[model samples]
Target: MSDAAAYACDNVSTPVEAVQAVLARDDLTPAQKQEIAQGFSARGLEFDVSEQVCVDQG
Candidate 1:
């Protein structure tokens, strides 16, 4: 597995948490973030934007 995939697997138990963790990272570019978001959608993993915002604020 790639380092990013390994990191995601290590950190998150679900797809939404994976996206949240990716969003929280300062290292990724916008394209990379978009790729992650697209990957989530392809997998049919849905998440609420408001919930993500609450997670960020918490």
Candidate 2:
């Protein structure tokens, strides 16, 4: 999913908050979780939760 959507899923803000959400999840693998963690290690990144984005109908 998009970064905003991922953050929205857990109602979080900032990379640290995003990582905390990832750690709390149970549907992903260690490597997948690690990759997400790495992505958040630096700034300017959009998380890849892989969930479908909800586009506007209007």
Q: Give me the candidate number with maximum lDDT.
A: 2
CA deviation > 4 Å runs, candidate 1:
1-13, 43-58
TM-score of 1: 0.44
The CA-based lDDT of model 1 is what?
A: 0.62
On TM-score, the candidate that comes out on top is 1
- Cα lDDT tens digits, model 1, 12-54, are 5675666788766778776676666666664435533222323
**Residue 44 error, candidate 2, Å:** 13
Query: Once model 2 is optimally superposed onto the true structure by TM-score, how far is the C-alpha of residue 12 displaced, in angstroms?
Result: 11
Against the true structure, candidate 2 has what lDDT?
0.66
- List RMSD in Å for every model shown: 9.7, 15.2
Error of 2 at 16 (Å): 1.1
